[model samples]
Target: MKIGRIETFYVPPRWLFVRVESDDGAVGWGEASLEGHAEAVDGAFEALRDRFIGHDPRRIEDIWQVSYRGGFYRGGPVLMSALAGLEQSLWDLKGKVVGLPAWEMLGGRVRDKIRAYAWIGGDRPSEIADAAKVRRDQGFSAVKMNATAELDWIGTPRLFDEVVKRVEAAQATGMDVGLDFHGRVHRPMAKQLAKVLEPLGLLFIEEPLLSENPDGLRQIAELTSTPIALGERLFSRWDFKPFFEMGAVDIIQPDLSHAGGILECRKIAAMAETYDIAVAPHCPLGPLALASCLQLAACTPNVAIQEMSLGIHYNVGHDLLEFCSDQQVLTPEDGYLRIPQGPGLGITIDEDAVREAHKERHRWRNPVWRHSDGSFAEW
Candidate 1:
């Protein structure tokens, strides 16, 4: 069947969902939420619709290639995210028609279940520990939090002490804690923080200096034993190649929605596999994005842990499984998300809720932070 209609909805709490319908009445759904840029992502689908409206729905890779290369500009958050949603929907549509899950189509099941981690507030030490305890009560064994809110070039000795204290409190709750530097820490402080936090048994330190600072990342990797995880900003396999070659990273956290679609991440995971590195698909978006990660986790053996957006600070009024009709499908059980066996992405979308939410289109943007001296600070 050929692609008939491609629709995009701007759901509440900063998420962009795509619904693809084929001429033969087949349907599939995917999420392309590039938080803070939902409107831009929605605008991106105009070109995709113009290019692939009458194209064969089964030609997944062909559509992906044309979408990426056809536009010589290529690879960025906006373009890749838009293509990622379209590509994921295509996989979902094809799997539904074939009566098998997307993972089965890729290869087969490599693992029965993948571990999941939730986000917690890390700006305050005591509060974060409380948040971690709450997550532990919710059946999560691991939780990730920002290392600091908005760090300057260098921090005080007290700042370091607070970081250690927060992690210690979380660990006391019998939860594995991963500190996200969030690209807010500059190079000078990144190395120092990494060295200090090295003693704690952290799951990983995400975005130690952002993916753009490969040289800085290599330096941080040399200074500490903590698994340096990154790649949420990098959009394609090409962007991931340098990190693998340099051996600057221990685990790669590619966002399924940001780094091309499912198959592209599978390829990236395979590349990381050769380097003996682990894959932890970075997903802090909607159910469709998490489902895409699960599909990747099912077939790719290197995926170590998955990130879910349940109870994350971003989901103010709406939560991760809110728009999903089958909430239990992606729910975490004992800190691990079971591999889905149903067709397509193995999660159902509440289209009516999505349509209604789209009525007051969300204009979500990340907060901009500045240092005490009025200079811009990464947030």
Candidate 2:
């Protein structure tokens, strides 16, 4: 079917959803947002929509090429995210026509259900422990939280004590706690934090420092045996080349929507597997994106676990599964969510819920933090 029109909505709690309608009745959905910047992503989609207006919605790879290589100055959060959404939408349309789920179309399932983790709050040790217990009670075997609220290049010993206490509280539940540095700590602090958390046992340390400096990443990697998982900020597979070649990272966390569409992320996952690095697709977004992640995880040999924001810290107005019609389809029983077995991206959007929530779309931006001396601090 030929592409008829592309529509977008900047939905609540910082998400942008795109709907691609074909000449026939086929429709596909995709989520492309980097927490903030929903409007920019929408503009990116609008600029690229003309290329697919009359093209076959089934030719996802060709459209991806046209949208990607089509722009010599390409591959940023806005463009790749936009292209990623369009590509996912096309795949959804194709899968629906063939009457198969995205994963099955991508060469069937590898595991029964991919293991997923919940996110616990950062900074508060007591609160984190209580949160871990709740998640464990709800059957989640793992939870991820920020290692620290904020940190300087070298913070106080009190901060380190607080970090250790948080880790201790989480470990009390006997559930693996993945500490996310959120790129808040520089290498100096990241190295020290890794050493401290090692005693408590960690699932992985996410973005210990930023992924910007690969050499610095190696420094953090050598300092601690805790698995270093990075690359949520990276937009393309090429961006991950140095990180992989360095052989420092034990796990690569590529967001399916940000890195590329399903096929591209699958290829990236395969590359990580060759490096003996595990894949845990980073998705703090919606169900369509989460479904795409699961599809890639299904065929990927090294996907250790998936990250889903069920009751995450940022769900002020919207949540995972609320935007979709088939919320029950994403039912997480005993910690793992069953893969969506229907055609296309598997889950269907509740247009009504989406439109209603879309009406109250939020202009969400991450808060900026500063140190006591009025110097900028990472948040």
Candidate 3:
């Protein structure tokens, strides 16, 4: 059937949902949004509708190529994220048409369940030890927290002690703690964070330095044995080549929403396996996003863990599954999420819930910070 109309809704707590309808009667839904820039991605989604209307919705790969390379200026957060959402919708449509789950279409699952991790501590982390205990007590095998806040190019020893205290609290729980430097720690602090935190046996240190400074990461990697994980800002396979060659990273954390959706991430995971690195798909987004990540993680042999934003601090009034009709299908039980067996991306959106939340759509932007000297700080 031909695609008849494409409709989009900007929903609450920073999300955009796209619904594709065929001339016959098939309907599919996709979430095409970046956290703060949902409106920009929404605009990109509308721009691509010209190419999608009246085309075959089932032509997944062809449409993907048209939506991505079809543009002259290509592949950044807004453009690629728009394309990523559209690609996920197409996959959802295809799976529904075939009456199979996304994983079945992707060579089936390599493992029955994928280990999942929870987020603890907010942007500027505090109460990390308490958060870690809470997550573990609730049956999460692992939890991740921000490494530091507003670090300078040259930070003081007090900030290092603060980080150490946070690490010490998390380690007290005996759960795997993944310290995310959040790319806030520069070379000076990154080295210190890794050197001091390594003694705590961190599961991984995420984004020790920004992906832009792979050289910085190389130095950070050399200084510590803690597994260095990067790639939340990276878009495609080409963006990842430098990290593979550096041989410093122990894990790669590509956001399924940001890293070209499920199919391309599978390709990346395969590439990571070649470099002897593990995969932990980064997802601090909603349900459809997490579902898409799990589909990839289920089939990917290199995947070490999956990041879910179920109760993450970024989720204020809403959560990962706030819009879903059946939350259990995207279930995380005993700290592992079973691959969804339902058709398409395997979870259905509650349109009533969607429209209800749409009534008060969010104008969410993160807080900006300033240090004592009136210089801007990373938030």
Tell me the tens digit of each residue's lDDT in model 1 across 1-379: 7999999999889889999999999999998989999988899999999999999999999999999999889999999999999989989999999999999999999899999999888566678788988888877999998888756787888889888998988898889999998898999998888989999989999998978789999999999999999989989999999999999999999998888899999999999999999998899899999999999999998999999988646587788888888888888889899999899999888889999999999999997887778888676
Number of the top-ranking candidate, with lDDT as the measure: 1
RMSD of 3: 1.9
lDDT of each: 0.91, 0.81, 0.81
> Model 1: what TM-score?
0.98
Judge candidate 3 at residue 278 and give its lDDT.
Answer: 95
Candidate 3 residue-wise lDDT at 113 = 86
lDDT (Cα, tens digit) per residue for candidate 2, span 9-124 = 87777888888898888998887876778878888876777677989888877888888898788898888888788778877888888888888877888887878898887457
Model 3, 178-235: lDDT tens per residue?
8887777668777876887878888999888888888888998998888999888888
Which 10-residue window of candidate 1 scores lowest in summed lDDT? 309-318
> What total of clashing residue pairs does each candidate reach?
0, 1, 0
RMSD to true structure for each model, in Å:
1.1, 1.6, 1.9
**Residue 42 miss distance in model 3 (angstroms):** 0.7
Model 2 Cα shift for residue 378 (angstroms) = 1.9
